[model samples]
Target: MVGALIIALGILSAGWLLLKALSRGQTADFTAIRLALARYLALALEFQLGADILSTAISPTWEQLGKLGAIAIIRTALNYFLSREMRDERGQTSAEKPVVERAD
Candidate 1:
């Protein structure tokens, strides 16, 4: 309960900071905040999934764990890739980032 609350608060605060920075035309700062928020969101997912693994009445424990690990890895990578795309959209990257947003 407490962990979830903390994660929620962190997400909100980071998102607020990102929006505020973007509104100020600080693209660099906004990108930084956006990355930070992504990290926090990943952590929250990891924590929640971990708790679910332990507490939830799920079947096939080992298989579930393996799938969870894969999911976490994929999700984290997706977030990073999306961040790169966003930065590219903002003209931060040297190469042109993909215009379409698709999960890897």
Candidate 2:
């Protein structure tokens, strides 16, 4: 239940950030928004994974273990992709910065 709550919080946080960003009239700043949302989601997934581990420790049934394994794998994959995208976005943002031209 706590894990579920954590996931919900993550989603809510992401939504809040999106709305806040949009409200600021800076639609072009999606990179920052995405990065922030992804970070929250990743942290929430970690908490969920930890919760799953704790649940399994208390009741090590085969079915429970299977479910935990599947969930962990899916969450991990999501986190990996999100992290990769965040890295790419950061690189692109940095590259898009305007270089100052000094007058001689």
Candidate 3:
């Protein structure tokens, strides 16, 4: 539950960063990063919610461990995706333009 909230906060922070990027005219790259972050955040929320449902439905069984495995896998994937999104955000840098060649 706490992890899910952290992921949500990350998504919100990424959104704010993306807004800053867009205001600086970095629409193309920022869009990609923003989408990635949003995706991971949503996935993390879904994973937690589903795990809660699973536990509610099943007290204990061999399937409990299997559900736990699924939860871990989903969380891992979300973490990887979030990492990639952060990298993408950092990559959206404003490149310094080369000075115009001085004509003779």
Candidate 4:
């Protein structure tokens, strides 16, 4: 239940950000918005994994354990890629910024 709620919140927050960006009249900082959404999704995935763990703990069937393992692997992969992408984007953004040289 809590996991679902958190996921729902993430979805709503991302949707709001998208709408806000769209309202900016073609001048929206889309990269920032995408980063924010990715962060939310990654967080939501964590909560979901926790929920799955809890659920499996209550019923230790082999089938349930297998499913949980698969889910965990998939979610972990997703989080890893998301983090990598975010890091790359941040690096790119920083590299694109103009660095001012100090005047002696």
Candidate 5:
């Protein structure tokens, strides 16, 4: 159900990244590509985390609860790093943008 959807989204994201890379060739902006992929990964992880929570809510089994907790922690860690990297990339991108001087 939700798990299958999550897997499908992940696969789609990977395929998109591959296609983007191939289309761009050597002129690819790796930072932008990384940011885009990271965004997709983060979104997919959030959906996965939500699904885990829902599963535990419906079952309340100790095994399910344990699995949910572990999965939540892992997803949180991945999202934290992905967000940090995105922030760094955005900062670098902004800094690299050309500044134009206004002539009065």
Candidate 6:
């Protein structure tokens, strides 16, 4: 129940942020928005994985174990890609910024 709530909250928050960004019209930085959504989704996935683990702990059936394993693998892959994308985005943003040289 808690996990579902967390996931819902994450989705709602991401949608709100996206809508807010869209309302900004031409001045909105989409890269930043994407980063924010990715972060929220990653967090939500973590909570979901935790919930699955808890469920498996309570009942150790073969079917349940297989389901958990598949879920874990999928979530882990998603998380890994999300994190990599976030890192790349951060690096790209930083690189795009103009660095001012200090005058002696």
TM-score of 1: 0.44
**Candidate 1 local lDDT, 1-94, one digit each (tens):** 6447756877888878877877888875455565566556656666666665565345657777687677667766765776666566456643
In model 2, pairs of residues that clash are: none
lDDT-better candidate, 1 vs 2: 2
**Stronger candidate by TM-score (1 vs 4):** 4
The lDDT of each candidate is 0.65, 0.83, 0.67, 0.84, 0.79, 0.84
Q: Residue 21 in candidate 6 has what lDDT? A: 68
Candidate order, TM-score descending: 4, 6, 2, 5, 3, 1
- The digit string of per-residue lDDT tens for model 6 on 1-104 reads 66567667767876787788677763446787678767877887898899899989996899999999999999999999999999999999999989999999
Model 3 scores worst on lDDT over the 10 consecutive residues at: 90-99
Cα lDDT tens digits, model 3, 39-103, are 66766666675766667566766677777777668766766776676566555543333458888
Q: Which 10 consecutive positions of candidate 4 have the poorest summed lDDT?
A: 25-34
Write the number of the candidate with greater lDDT, choosing between 1 and 3: 3
Off by more than 4 A, model 2:
1-24, 101-104
Cα-based TM-score, every candidate: 0.44, 0.77, 0.45, 0.80, 0.76, 0.79
Clashing pairs in 1: none
Residues 20-78, model 2: lDDT tens digits: 87888778777776777677777777888888899899969999999999998998998
lDDT of 5 by residue, 1-104 (tens): 65457556766776687787788684546676677667777887888788779878986988888888888999899999989999999999999999999999
Better of 5 and 6 by TM-score: 6
Model 1 scores worst on lDDT over the 10 consecutive residues at: 89-98
For candidate 6, give the lDDT of residue 97: 88
User: Between prediction 3 and prediction 6, which has the larger TM-score?
Assistant: 6
lDDT of 2 at 77: 96
Pairs that collide in candidate 4 are none
